[model samples]
Target: MTSHYDWRGGREAMMRFGLADAPVVVIAPPPFEEANRLRALMATVARGLARQGLAAVIPDLPGTGESLTDIAATRLADWRDAFAAANEAAGPVRLIASVRAGALFDGGQGAVGHWRLTPQDGSRLLRELVRTRIAGLREDGREASSATLTEIARNDGIELSGHWFTPALFGDLEEAAPLPAHPLRTVRLDGDAQPADHRLAAAPLWRRAEPGNDLELAQLVADDIADWMRTCLGG
Candidate 1:
């Protein structure tokens, strides 16, 4: 079902699935372009969770998804606060499921447990975006270096891909890292060297050049989340 939640900024859309009285799992989607790439897969996972009798919600944070907020005006703090507000509205959220950069803001929701998939820090995400921007510039016969772009972002803000990021948002992202939450379960792709509570053999959908879906991977994620929720809920 589609619903809206009100935060200090305003109302944003949220998609809910599964039994209304079931345990709730709030999904914090990956930021920016990765969010687009992973959208279908996330929705699939939500549906799978629904089939397992878990209520899953994916909220549209301010400046992302179908939101009225201007991207340039949004700060990381706004996302965190909005996510917390969304959690409050989601009705006793038992777990937070976050992927990649989503981990950065998932902690403020106060869920009983957090499940992260290959969580990434802001600096690395910025670097990847800068590289993509530089590549686009090179293709356009313009030149820009990472250091120069970083300086520009720090002072005057900058546009990456299609999103306009303010200096405050840029600075916030540069220093942002995933917050530590108790009963955290980290999942990574099989080959990733990062520490994770579990590793699954699945391709990184967020890195794809085009948006796609993998039902198998989504089912795996849903199953893992179901198990984690069971443990977190003492079931």
Candidate 2:
């Protein structure tokens, strides 16, 4: 049975399955458009894990997914703390963190089971962050000049949306550490293991579109999660 519970500045919604005592898979969601895009995939993976005798909790971190916080007020530390709280609620947890969320495991934080999909390149992510911030400002009817954008990027106290953009978040992100030295399994995008250090557990990258359009990327992400659970849980 799937149920919802309020948790740490947010609500934790989860589905339970099989032996009431099974270990849990707590899924930490990705961010922004990616979260919506990957929702189905996360659900599929949760269900798949449940079928295999593992319970799963897929919560919308404090600000995302019907939670109290919106995109603007959601900060990186808030997400990290949310994951930790979710793990506590789920009991001994194996975490499936996707995209940018994968970075949370860097400092050996609340990690039990770790899995990542399409791990982001942190530097590129920062660049894209700038673009996103600028575009968001424009969309909000705020005049965004190149100078303004540069100033925002340089400052750590600027408010984008409602959250304070801090240099610490960017620094930690840029330093993208190795998956906390713990037992971790990963599946990468459709490419050979570029990171020679960690061998990818799965190589197939599912597609939601025929051959183009990034909008279809969500389908691929969802499929990837579903496939990973099916293979890992033998469901």
Backbone clashes per model, in order?
0, 4
Q: Highest lDDT, which number?
A: 1
> Where does the lowest 10-residue lDDT sum fall in candidate 1?
105-114
Give the per-residue lDDT digits (tens) of candidate 1, residues 111-213.
8788999999999999999999999999999999999999999999998877888999999999999978888999999889889899998998888898899
For model 2, the run of ten residues with the poorest summed lDDT: 203-212
Evaluated with TM-score, which candidate comes out highest? 1
Model 1 error, position 146 (Å):
0.7
- Candidate 1: residue 107 lDDT (0-100): 64
Q: Give the TM-score of candidate 1.
A: 0.97
Show where candidate 1 strays beyond 4 Å.
none
Which regions in candidate 2 have their CA more than 4 angstroms from the true location? 1-19, 70-73, 93-100, 105-112, 121-123, 132-150, 153-179, 196-235
Superposed Cα deviation of residue 81, candidate 1 (Å): 0.3
